[model samples]
Target: MRAVTYDSYAKDNSRLEYREVPDPKVGPGQVLIQVRAASVNPVDWKVMAGGLDGMMDAVFPVVPGWDVAGVVSRTGPDTPEFAPGDEVMAYARKDVVQGGTFAEYVAVDAPAVAHKPAALDWAQAAGLPLAGLTALRSLERLGVGPADVLLVHGAAGGVGSLAVQLGRDRGARVIGTASERNHAFVRELGAEPVSYGDGLTDRVRALAPGGVSAVADFVGGQLETTLAVLTDGGRHVSVADPTVEQHGGHWIWVRPDGAKLAELAAVVDRGALTVEVAQTFPLERTGEAFDASRTGHTRGKLVLVP
Candidate 1:
């Protein structure tokens, strides 16, 4: 099988190579997915650069991706949830850093796999797992509901965009912070857009006067902004910053739950949710896809078709 592999951690993505690699082995409770599409997350490049070295161990020549959407080619023992020919998607991160979704095939634990949303094509479905799961987890931690007013940082980002819609779906009045260029896009996602900069607090205050009831920070370094605009007893969470824990806010690391992903897929199929794909790359151009993700300006996901 051909896949993208990096020999070692570096400051940049120059080491990424597209070449032949052995097909992943399916262990009990795992399923083999013939990779149709894989999406690039900032974490992919960060992992390639050893950003997570303190927490996770890495194997050399590591395949680099976690989000996959494809057809099930085979299933291992004890996996009764799915069979061959099933269209599936998964947040396929493992404790060890190897056998990722950037390959022609990947073996995923059945508990982490969900049937791909029929409403989404391959690229959009590939983009949904990680980002959607992160947003769902963050909102769940914040306890967003009809009575709460939600403030989302980086509103136009991959996770933030979904957070905005999911927050609204849960009946929260969402206020999202983005640049002038993304205000309309944020609005389209069902949030009142506020410019994120010098007068951020004042801008949010103008919209919510009393203060927002909850905050979900997708872009890190927004702790000050979160504190400034949140109500005194409001809940807040961050996926990027861990220091939020020190201040009564939760730091979220999304767990893989096939049931929760299946629920999210239902939302997409019902037309209450949408997945945005900014661009698509052939499997071999993964490095270029990483370059685009590093820019941090793309409104949606960057996916690779294998």
Candidate 2:
């Protein structure tokens, strides 16, 4: 199998290289997937740079990626949820980062695999698992509902953009903060677009003078803005900020759940969800993709075609 991997942590993505590697083994209760596409996330590069080593352990020569949309090529013993020809998508992060989805093959636990949405192509499906799960998890933690007004920071980015659509699907009056250039893009995603930074709190207040009922901070460093705009006792959560717990808000990490991924796929098939890919790269050019991701300027996802 050809995979992009790094033998050690490096500040730059230069360590990421395309090489022929051993194929992943399918353990019992898991399935081996033939990778069609994989998407890049900040965490992928961060993990490659040893950012999470203090918390999540990583095995050296790690193949760094979690989001995959592929076809099941083989099944392990006792794996009954899927067969050899099933199309699947997964947030396949393991306790230790080793054989990841950035390769031609990955062995994933059956519980973390879901059928890809028929409405989405391999690249779009690849973009959904991690970003969709993060968005869904944030909305779930914030307890967003029909009557509430939900405010999302950094709403034009991957997770924030998904959160905007999901928030609206939940029946919340969704307001999304984005750069002026992305305002129209955010509006198209079913959120009322608001300019981010400077007077963000005041702008949201003008839109909903009574105050937003819930806030999901995808960009982090918005504690002050969130506190200012949220109604007292309203819900708030952040995936990027752990200090949120001290401010009466929840900090979230998306878990691997095939059931939740299926629900997200249902939304996609129902025409309520869609993905935008800013760029695509072949597996050999993964390092360039990482460089682009580090720019943090892309409005959509950067995907790898294996």
Candidate 3:
């Protein structure tokens, strides 16, 4: 099998390499997937550069991607939820050492995957798992509902884009913050777009005079802005900065839940949710994908076809 991997934690170009590798074998509760597509997240680049060195325990020579969409090629002994040839998508467990999806094959835990939405292609499905799950967890933790006014930061990026659409589908009045170039794109996702810059807090205040009921900060640097617009007792959640214990807000680390993913797949199939793929590259160009992701201005997810 062909795989892209890093020999050490460094910049994307310093370590990422595409090469032939032995095929992975399934374990007792794992399923082997013939990967068609995988997507890059900030975490992939972060891990590749050793940015999560203290926060996460990772083995050297790690495969970095978490989002995967592919066909099932084989299953472990006790697995019965899927059979060979089922199309599936998932966020592989963060704790895994060698099971990342940036390859021709991956042995994923059977309980971490669900059928890919029939309405989406392999690339779009590949973009959904990690970002979609993060958005879902953030909204769930904030208890956002139809009557609430939800504020989302970095609304044009992968997780934020999904969050905006999901908030609108859940009946919340969605407000989003993004750069001037992405204002129209965010608006198209059904959120009131507020330009993110020096006066972000003021912009948000101007839009929602009564104050925001819930806040989800996908961009960690905008913590102060999110705090400024949220009303007292408002629900606040962040997927980027989980150490926010001082502000009466909660942090979300996306977990792999096949059942929750199943529900999200249903929403996608029903046209209630959408996954955006900003760009696609072959596995050999994984370094280029990481460079684009680190630029912090990608309109949506960047995918790698393996």
Candidate 4:
């Protein structure tokens, strides 16, 4: 099997290289997947650069990716939920391994995966697990409903885009902040788009005169700005900054939940959710994908077709 892996942690050292590595074997409660596609998230790059070294207790020669869509090639002895050849998608547990998705095959915990929606292709399904789960978890915390007005920062990016759509599906009125170039795309996701730079708070306030009922700040730098437009005791959440305790908000770190993934799959099957892939690259181009993500302006998710 060929894989993209790094022996050390640094931007300069994170070059892609191919090697004849042994394929992973499934253990108890695990399933081996023939990876078709995997999406890159900020966590991927962060882990690659050792940003979470203290938190994760990572080892060297890590492969960093969590979002995957593939076909089950083998199931462990005790696994009864799925069989060989089942199409599946999942977010890998962040702590077990840095990432195993940048390869032809990888072993995943059976409990972390759900059946992939037949309506979606590998690339689209690959983009959903991490971002979609984050959106679902944050919205659940917000308790958003038809009577509420929800605000999402960085609405054109992966998590923000999904959050906007999921919020709309739950009947919440959504207002999203993005760059001018992504305004139309964000609006198409069922949210009113507000420009994110300079006076963004005022722009959001203008859109929701009475103030938003909840806020999800995908971009942590705009914390103060988002706080300004949220009503008192309004649900506030951030995925980027977990240290944020000042605004009565909680930091949301997405976890692997097959039940939630099942619900997300149903939404996708019913045409209520969509996964947008801005670009796709081969495993050898992992470094380039990280570079693209660092530019901070990708319209949607970036994926790797392994």
Candidate 5:
């Protein structure tokens, strides 16, 4: 199997290389997926640079990816949930960081795999698991609903884009913060777009009048904006800032849950949600993909086709 690997933490991402590696062995409760498409997230480059060393143990020559959309080529014993040829997707994060979704094939625990949504193409399906799951969890934690004014930071980015739609579907009047260039795109996602940066609080206040009922921070460094615009006793959560917990808000980290992923897929199938893909790269050009993701400027997901 040919896969991209980094021998060690390289802040410059100089160690990423594509080469032949041994095929993964399927263990009990695991299923082997022939990788069709893998999505690039900021964490992929961060992990390659040792950003998560304290949180996860990384084996040498680590493969870098987590979101995958593919077909089952093989299934391990006791994995009665799926068989070969099943089209599936997953946020396939394991306790260890060596075997990831960027390879030609990856073996995932059955509990973290879900049937792919028929409405999404390979790139879109690959983009959904992590971003969709994160958005879903954030909204669920905040208990967003009708009669609430929801504020979403980074509303045009990967996770934020999905959060905007999900919030609107829940009947919340969503106010999304994005750049001037992305305001139109954010508005298309069903949110009233507001430009972020200086005077962000005023922009949001102009829309909500009193303050927002909830704030979902998909991009970090928005604690001040969140605190300023949230109504009294309102809810807030941040995937980028753990300090939110100290300020009476939740710092959310998404987990691998197949059941939840399936539910998100159903939402897509019902035409209530959609995944946006900004670009697609071949397996060998992962370095370029990572660079693009690190820029934080892309409007949607960046996918890799293996």
Candidate 6:
């Protein structure tokens, strides 16, 4: 099998290279996937650069990535949930960081895999898992509910884009923060767009005089903005800032949960949510994909076609 690998956590991309490697083995309660498509996220590059070393122990010669949409090649014993040739997707983060989805094949624990949404093409499915899961997890953590008014900072970003639509599906009126260039795009996702600088609170106040019922911050440095727009005792969560806890807001770290992945897929299938894949690269160009993701400018997902 040919896969991208790095022997050590480097500060640069000089270590990434594509080469032949032994295929990942299916362990108990796991299944091997023949990867069709995977997507790049900021954490992929961050992890490769050793940014998450304290959070997750890594094995050398690491294959770095997590988002995947692929077909099952085989299953390990006791895995009755799926069989050969099942089309699936996952936020396949394991306890270890060596066998990621950026390869021709990856082994995933059954608990982290879900059937791909029927409405999505391979690219969209590949991009959906991590971003969608992050958005969903943050909203759930904030206890966002129907009839609530929600504010989404960085609402045009990878996770924010989905958060806007999911908030709408929950029957909340969503106010999304974006630049002028992305206002139309954010509006298309069912959010009322507000420019993200200076008068952010005033714009949100114009839309919701009583303040919003919940706030999800996908971009960091928005603790001030979130606190200002939120009603008294309103819910709030942040994926990018741990300091949110100091302000009585929850800090979320997404985990692999197949059941929640399936629920998100159903939302996509029902036409209540959609994924935006902005650009794609071939398997050998995984590093290039990461480069684009790190720019923090793409309005949608970056995919790796394996």
lDDT of each: 0.94, 0.92, 0.88, 0.87, 0.94, 0.92
Best of the two (1, 2) by lDDT? 1
Query: Candidate 2, overall lDDT?
Result: 0.92
Worst 10 residues of 5 by lDDT: 200-209
TM-score of each: 0.99, 0.98, 0.97, 0.97, 0.99, 0.97
Runs of candidate 2 with Cα error greater than 4 angstroms are: none
Find the 10 residues in a row with the least total lDDT in model 1. Answer: 9-18
In candidate 3, stretches whose alpha carbon ends up further than 4 angstroms from where it belongs are: none
lDDT (Cα, tens digit) per residue for candidate 4, span 96-194: 554568888888998889999999899999999999999999999889899889999999999999999999999999999999989999989999999
Q: Which stretches of model 1 miss by more than 4 angstroms? A: none
Worst 10 residues of 2 by lDDT: 293-302
Rank by lDDT, descending? Answer: 5, 1, 2, 6, 3, 4
Model 1 lDDT per residue over 1-306, tens place: 999999999878789899999888899999999999999999999999899999999998899999999999999999999999999999999999988999899999999999998899999999999999999999988889999999999999899999999999999999999989999999999999999989898999999999999999999999998998889899999999999999999999997888999989999999999998999999899989999999988898999999
Which of the two, 1 or 3, has more lDDT? 1
Cα lDDT of model 6 by residue, 38-108, tens digit: 99888889899998999899998999899999999999999999999999999999888888988999999
User: For candidate 2, what is the TM-score?
Assistant: 0.98
Per residue, candidate 2 scores C-alpha lDDT tens digits across 223-280 of 9999998898899999889999998999989999999999999999999999888889
